[model samples]
Target: MQVPDVMTAIEISTPGGPDVLVPGKRPVPQPGPGELLVKVAAAGVNRPDVLQRRGAYPPPPGASDLPGLEVAGEVVAAGQGATHLIGTNVCALVAGGGYAEYAIAPAGTSLPVPEGLSMAEAAALPETLFTVWINLFERGFATEGEWALIHGGTSGIGTMAISLCKLFGVKAVVTCGGDDKCAAALKLGAAAAINYKTRDFVNEVRQLTGGAGVNVVLDMVGGDYIARNLAVLADDGRHVSIATQRGVTAEVSFLDIMRRRLTLTGSTLRPRTLAFKTLVAEELRATVWPFVESGQLRPVMDRTFPLREASAAHARMEGGDHVGKIVLTV
Candidate 1:
């Protein structure tokens, strides 16, 4: 097949706001060994992408300077070691380069899209779902019947966490900003939704758990939430931090941690070795993909914009009013 000479992309020339994301043309990237050249149909816009646009989190090392982290599309070409994935409709968790007409994806990180999902929905899954699964289940050891607290309850990660918890019979309590967001979380199988603006989530979580606190807490909000998170943990509870939207620095009580026997941990999807991501992909394919295929687990998309309108997509994500994932249609 003849590949196009150039492809349209959303480029951030300098760090700032959505205005920084300007549409531009770039040569189509070729797949290297163990890679697949994907014709991107849709790409998810994540908070990290926004941070990257602001120059706070640049792509690590050899990863694309382009913003997108997850994409869904058809495989148009494959490198020498990626022959088996050619022509597959795949959704991949990419290191970068997804905010374009075409991007190269590592073969091992690409998975066949669930039978009935659209490219947009598939694009929305990889980053948030991968983050939630790795932190909550892989690191936190969340199991059936255990209570889990997910901060940012109405977010893409939070919604996916709630759905997976529901599918596995685990109880989930989520924290969001408003009543509507709380209601949305509840509808998505959060056993209880706490409006962080109106209520103290730490106290509400304790009360909801009958003063026992939760077995695990997935926190994206850092800073002040840190001290309170430690206070709300059950004995032996796992607290995992994936992002620090508020701030990273905080003063917390070490005594509380010691007394509760808590385990505090966190991870970023990027920067990990390819072997680790391949393992995560394999685990998701074996354990989580089945539920997605069965429609028991679904991507909750709040909005979408055309690839040319990437600025608007970023703005919507920053607005914080969205209930779930945001996507850029290509």
Candidate 2:
């Protein structure tokens, strides 16, 4: 296939709201060493994209200025180590540039789209899967038979975490905003779904665990929740955070951490070196791809929009009404 010289893309015209996103023309990015030039079919919208558009998070050095993190497409061209992937359809975790007709992705971070999945569904897999695997599983060492308390259980990553925990025999308890979201989480195999809008999660978690507390707490809401998260952990439990949606700063008692033998950690994907991403990609491909291929793991896609309507997609995402991922078709 002949690749395009230029492509249509959504650009941040100004750092502000969803309306700030506008269509523009740009040269189609070519594959660099260890990269693939993908003819993007669909792209997943994530909360970080919203943060980037609001100027809260900037693209890392050398990453595309565009604000998309994951894309599923056919590899039309390859560079260096990526040559083997030419002509294959795959989903990738990209640093940026996914919201375009053509996008570049590092070969290591790309994986074949699971059989029987559409581009939009595959597009939804990479970001949330990578986030959950790295933060909730690897860093937290989420283990079988233990309980994990997941925040935002109806969100993309939350849904994946719940399913994965169930698949691997780790029980999951989750917090969502409403009854419907709570029901959705429970349907997805969460052991318990707490509607934080109606109940105090700390008390509910304690009640659900019979006072033993959860073995791991996957947190996205930081600040005030950090203290409470630590409070609800079992002895030697892990507290892994992937985002700080509530706020960043928190006052925690060191004595509590030491006495409980708790671990607190977090990570952001884009700024990491390609080598770090490569390690994560290898692990996911080996450990998680089987579950994906067997249909036990799948994207919980909520909605989609045409590429030109990127702003509207963002509006829907920020509205927080959707239960799962929103994708952009290119």
Candidate 3:
């Protein structure tokens, strides 16, 4: 592959709305030790990208200033000890710069783009997969035959949760904003989908679980939902917070948590240590890659836009009308 000196990337020209995402030229980054330089075919648009655009989430120290978290492409170059990956198709979880024509990815975090998956679908996997796996399964401890309540049923994270739950035999009950989104979630393998705009998700989940309540809750909408989430958790249930879309802080009853033996926890993936992310990549390769290769696991795509139309992509995401993952194709 002929590597370029300069590449087009979507940059946050200023901290504001989606219109702030502007296409700009940047020097193509070089791969450091244990890194691969990928010719980016597609990059997944995520909530963090939008936050970064609005100045709410900034790139970690030494990371690229561009806004993309996952990308799928071919490895065009590699640093020492990772030369074997050159010329291979892969989708990788990146710290930043995925919105560019070229992006550097950690060699350990890149996974093979299997024959059955398209570049866009592969691009959509890493962020949501790593997030749901870490929070819902590893931290929440959702297991076979257990019931889980997930907010944002039709969003990227919600759909991935539903798919993983179905594959692992966990029953997923999700909350969506509209009837159409709820229907979409049900069709995507959720045990039940609640239209939160019209119905009380707490009562719906309780009723759906036959009054025993859910064994776990994967929450993106915090604030009042935190207390309501606790209301619907079964004894010894786990509540894992992945985002605070509604608000950050909430009042919770310590007595209620103690009485039910409930657990509350959360994490952000971007600032984590490289070694920890590498370990997660290895675990996903061992456990989840099989399903992906077999064509059983795939991202539910909402739409795609040209790389230069990244502002439009951000607008679509913030509008909250997209049902699944959105991608920017190079």
Q: Which model scores highest in TM-score? A: 3
Q: Candidate 1 or 2, higher lDDT?
A: 2
Whichever of 1 and 3 has more lDDT, that candidate is 3
**Top candidate by lDDT:** 3
Q: Please give each candidate's TM-score.
A: 0.98, 0.98, 0.99
Worst 10 residues of 3 by lDDT: 201-210
| C-alpha lDDT of residue 180 in model 1 | 94
lDDT of 1 by residue, 1-330 (tens): 678989999999899999999999999998999999999999999999999999999899999999999999999999998988887899999999999999999988888996789999999999998899899998989999999999999889999999889987889999999999998998888999999899998789888989999999899999888888887889999999999988999997778788878999999888888889989999999999998888877899899999999999998988999999999999
Per-candidate Cα lDDT values, in order, are 0.92, 0.92, 0.95
lDDT of 2: 0.92
Residue 23 lDDT (model 2): 94
Model 2 segments more than 4 A misplaced: none
Ranking by lDDT: 3, 2, 1
Candidate 3 per-residue lDDT over residues 89-130, each given as its tens digit: 999999999999999999988999999799999999999999
Across residues 1-330, which tens digit of lDDT does each residue of candidate 2 receive?
987788999999989999999999999988888999999999999999999999989999899999899999999999998899999999999999998999999999999986688999999999999999888888999989999999999888898898789888999999999999999988989999999989999999999999999999999999899999999999999999889988999999999899888898888878988889989999999999998898888888799999999999999988888888999998
Judge candidate 3 at residue 281 and give its lDDT: 96
Q: Please report how far candidate 3 places residue 235 from its true position, in Å.
A: 0.2
Ten-residue stretch with the least lDDT total in model 2: 265-274
